[model samples]
Target: MALFAVLSGLSACGLPRSGPTKGEIRAGSVEEQGDTFIVPVTAQVARATAMVPPLGFTNGFLGAGVIGSDVIRPGDVLGLTIWENVDNGLLAGPGMNSTALQEMQVDGDGFIFVPYAGRIQAAGNTPEALRRIITEKLDAQTPDPQVTVARIAGDGATVSVMGGVGGQGVYPIERPTRTLSAMLAKAGGVIIEPEIAQIVVTRGHHTGRVWLKDLYSNPQFDVALRPGDVILVEKDQRNFTAIGATGAQNRVHFETQELSAIEAIAQVGGLSTNAADPTGVFVLRDEDPATANTVLGRTDLIGPQRVAYVLDLTEPSGLFNARDFMIRDGDTVYVTEAPYTRWQKLLGALTGAAGSANSLSKAAGN
Candidate 1:
């Protein structure tokens, strides 16, 4: 009776489990509360979910023409030099024939104060335009007045670049740095990996974003930048959690701009060979109402719904379908253990119990 009790206790001991079984997962779904949704990964589902809105520059950013780099702004500084034909003219003094006025900052109201020219609007006008205006004003006082205006450094036609960039500072918009990609290069390029790099451009109230690689691949994404534009180069924050019977379960970041389900699985070292159930691989995520309805082909669900997408690798077209399926951010990839694994554990326990019983019999005989 004691030997039988020992064998029964060993067989009934709780077995260690990597994750819930396939049948258990299906049974755990709550229809009323919308806790878990089990949906098979079909061709239609893959195509539907792949229709997520892509990020890029919109018409507001794309349609705007490139701004003139030579144009002056309110915060710009100017160096004015006045050369008069006569030796003691209005600007020049004594034996001096020319007068140099350096570091003339344009005021907030877009005006710069000159001795003879009074208050001149220098913000909208270029250096040459300012020269003509100053020459006209000083001509009455000094005969044949010659004026030259040179733009110095300031906040005019500039952008603020920060975050994950080689150089973080205010960059002036020059001829070579007029567009989004050009400005990124002006900032010494992105510091993070290009594949996972994302560029965000904020102009006024509007904001646009695109992958760093897309700037070259898609020319339309390289939109013209405006003054006061704030650009940020950052690494992709999108990542998924891998658990259950995978090679190494952890939070895996996206390696590329667009990650497919197969690629996501491979990044986590693929499914566990020994214990993984090929038909039980699941990708779990919280789907928005629209996406949830589309995937389940039902309209009763509302708000964010819990969805578990099952992928059967044993199918004939499983690999191809998985390659087409897209994995989103904050998703969980779970691979349930095979049914035979639990039975194997039970058999191993029974063998160990039998070995203990045989040892007791040997000791009694001795």
Candidate 2:
């Protein structure tokens, strides 16, 4: 009876569990585990995941305009010329005589003075419009007067560029709508060692931004700049940490564009084959309580928005979930030991010791 009891105790079946069972893991935990855990990604969960907190202006909402003809502005010098046919000319005889070309600067008030056309608002009006105005004024004195208004020098239509560029200064807006790439190139192009990804364009109260390379590759994203727009090129700083069973435990830098959970894991060299718990992949993120409360139902458990998101790699769909899930900055990706890992190890050790004891008892009886 004693030998039979010993043998029964050493059996591998019905191992003691010190952690959550498979059923508990599948059903999902709402028992105050301190995470905004959502199972099966229901409608509410989908809504929250889809939500992107407004960052002042929407993505790609900068001053992206199509390029067009340039407009005259204040401080611009204009070459005004007037010609007369001399038929009904009150200023000249029957012979053809053209007035000397006059170069005048647009005043502070955006007005330019002409021989016949009194100070006309040239800053807000296009060159062609100002030419017509000059022709109309000259018509009173000179019959069939021909007037031409050309921009000699641009004075005020400019954009200020700073930060990580070869040339940083007030470069004139060359076109009616100057593209971001054109503006950057006019400012002597970006520095060799500069951050080519994060570029910012601020126009009055509204601002728009896009990757420098993306602007070049996709002309649509390379938005046009307004007169007073400021372009700031800066480096990226957001990074995430991978701990517990991952090959590398150090923090890894994120890409300028959106980064997903699966990509982040790959950056840290992925989970350990022998130490990782495929079912316990947890993404601990610092979420805003007010925002999390609105998105996720339970905010009473952990007030600060520090929520753990579970990813079960054991399931085939878990990898797909991770691939679609975006990872925010300052997040922690942790993989726990398997639930049955400890129990199996303990059982092997106990069985080995039992076999040793039984062998010793038989030797003593011999």
Candidate 3:
């Protein structure tokens, strides 16, 4: 009797209820629990759902390029300079010097006022192209004219870098810094944490995010930067908690925007060989309440829109199903302990206690 009591105590302390009861794992309802939906692990079940997480670098964000042909636009200021070997007329007229400097601003109609050239169109041409236009216009009047145009100041070629960057300021989107990666480097990369996986890029009315981990592997997302584009490099503050018979019972930080269930399981060190039940591995997720019924295919379910997915790793195809199942940011993985493990704890406890009690009894008798 003393041995039995000691064994029970040790069993309870060691095994400590690895997870929910078998019946609870097998039978649970959205209506009863107020939000838990039960999903079985199967290829069809995993295939039924479609999620476009911000993971791959080649998503819709790369489909489009910079705005308006990347051409010059209004609000741009250009500094125009002209050189003449011999002064003739217009730019370098009779009494003028060999060089003429003019500061021009692109007006609302995408035109710039050039001396003697009248309202010339500068908004849609490159600096070199604009120089040629001006030089050509003065070809007959001026003798051997050379012209240069520089973007002195403009909002159309500048981008704003904010959030998780060393230089959180506006930088020009010059030819060398026209791509996302170029701007990131010029801004001193991510300051808060370069390890972050997502960078939010907003251009005009459309806003999208990219996974930096994928970007490092894929160059497609290193898209050309556009005027008015805002780049935000934020920390990868997403995580999921792992508990129960799995190796670790702590919050696992996200390394990428999307994480496969199997990846998450592997990160937590897989299941505990001694205690984990191959069939009792589960993931708890809180789905959107409004679409849970239709999405989960359980009209009978009623509760708080939380769902649990049971993965039976015993089957050969179980790993495939888990691979396809994407884990959300805050899901929890639980691997219930096997029934035999519980029994072993009890038996071992009883054996040690029994030996101690037997020795005590012998000592008293002596």
Candidate 4:
């Protein structure tokens, strides 16, 4: 009779007499218990970090433009035009003509020496500014000398594009009103499944990322390219691991441009029939052992919580919209089965018969 009472009490407590230790529950089981106890599904409460659709750019979004606002440099040719002035003893007819025309190339020092005008700074000055400087110098020698400067060779600005593009090269900035899209267009756009948001632009020592969607949707997020700017578009890494009881028992590779938790599960062919607990889905982000130990010691716990996230998919509604949650670059998702999941169907049939037999005995006693 005492042994029977002990058996009944053990069954009521829902714990087996002897089984796995607390350390052997696996990280997945702990998450399941937390969800079941803290946030009951019957309560209709939403998970703290449920996945949602990404919000694209907003506001007065403008396109990125080319860089053309810098001073002229060496290796640039200048076309100089001196007007034919005859009234002030300047004639343009023959070798002895007073109107002498010449094209001057700036030396390494950015100085251009004219016939009558001594040394004049030509580098780091706009064409218009250079023309004004020459006019002032020639005015001292030849009265009312007219001068015009024209750029015949190189512009001092360029931008680079690489990765996931048809052609990766440095593009010369031809216009001042160039935008990010315009630059990509110049590079023939990105390849299929390109990580648009991962585009990196480096200028000098500063680096920044420009989201392609943001550049198109948000008017205020336009990233302007400058001279010596380098734009790198690299292919995003797509790989994940799946453990626990599932239909397949191996890691899978998803070639999706952007993968989510629900989509990742589908790639592995869904959960196993008899071994899967729909609500026991978790993501384990393996961290450095040193870091894990530090975090565990702070909380005075035996082991650290390396489990990044625990997602409950038991509810039909939750499973239906699981695709909205985004997964990280390299994450391990585990699917565990509930303890009752494998026994509930069998226990139901025996429980009914046992209850009927007990009721009949009580009625007979009455």
Best prediction by lDDT: 1
The better candidate by lDDT, 1 or 4, is 1
Going through the candidates in the order shown, the clash numbers are 0, 0, 9, 10
lDDT of 2 by residue, 1-366 (tens): 875465456533454433344345445544545334433432344346544332223444543555443677777777776678765454444564665555587889898777556767888777788888888887877678887777653456667889878888766675533777877887777773433256788878867665666666665667656667788876555788887777788888876456777888888888777767877777766666664676566556445655567777657677777777777778887766664565565657577788999999999999
Off by over 4 Å in 3: 1-21, 24-35, 50-147, 152-156, 161-169, 174-199, 203-206, 211-226, 233-238, 254-258, 289-291, 294-296, 299-304, 351-366
Best candidate, TM-score: 1
Write model 4 residue lDDT over 1-366, tens digit each, in one string.
864564455455564222222223442343566411122222122222242234332222223443454455664556677753544444344543244344456677887776667788887888789888988877766667777776543333466788867778866554442556677777887774544335667767766665565556665555666666777766434578887656565667655555777888878888777767676676656433443344333334343245344566767666544555555556777777666653553355346657999999999999
Model 2 bad stretches (over 4 Å): 1-30, 33-155, 164-166, 188-196, 212-223, 235-237, 287-305, 337-366
How are the candidates ranked when ordered by TM-score, highest leading?
Answer: 1, 3, 2, 4
Candidates in order, TM-scores: namely: 0.78, 0.53, 0.61, 0.52
Kindly report which residue stretches of model 4 are placed more than 4 angstroms away from their true locations once superposed: 1-23, 26-47, 50-70, 74-108, 111-122, 125-156, 194-197, 244-259, 272-279, 286-305, 308-312, 320-324, 337-366
Per-residue lDDT of 14-43 in model 3, one digit per residue for the tens? 545766755576567654654456777688
Off by over 4 Å in 1: 1-13, 30-34, 79-104, 112-121, 131-153, 347-366
TM-score of 2: 0.53
- Worst 10-residue stretch by lDDT in candidate 1? 3-12
Which candidate, 2 or 4, would have the higher lDDT against the true structure? 2
lDDT score of model 3? 0.74
lDDT of each: 0.86, 0.66, 0.74, 0.58
Q: In lDDT terms, how accurate is model 1?
A: 0.86
Residue pairs of candidate 4 with colliding backbone atoms: 60-219, 61-218, 61-219, 63-179, 64-178, 64-179, 64-180, 65-178, 65-179, 66-178
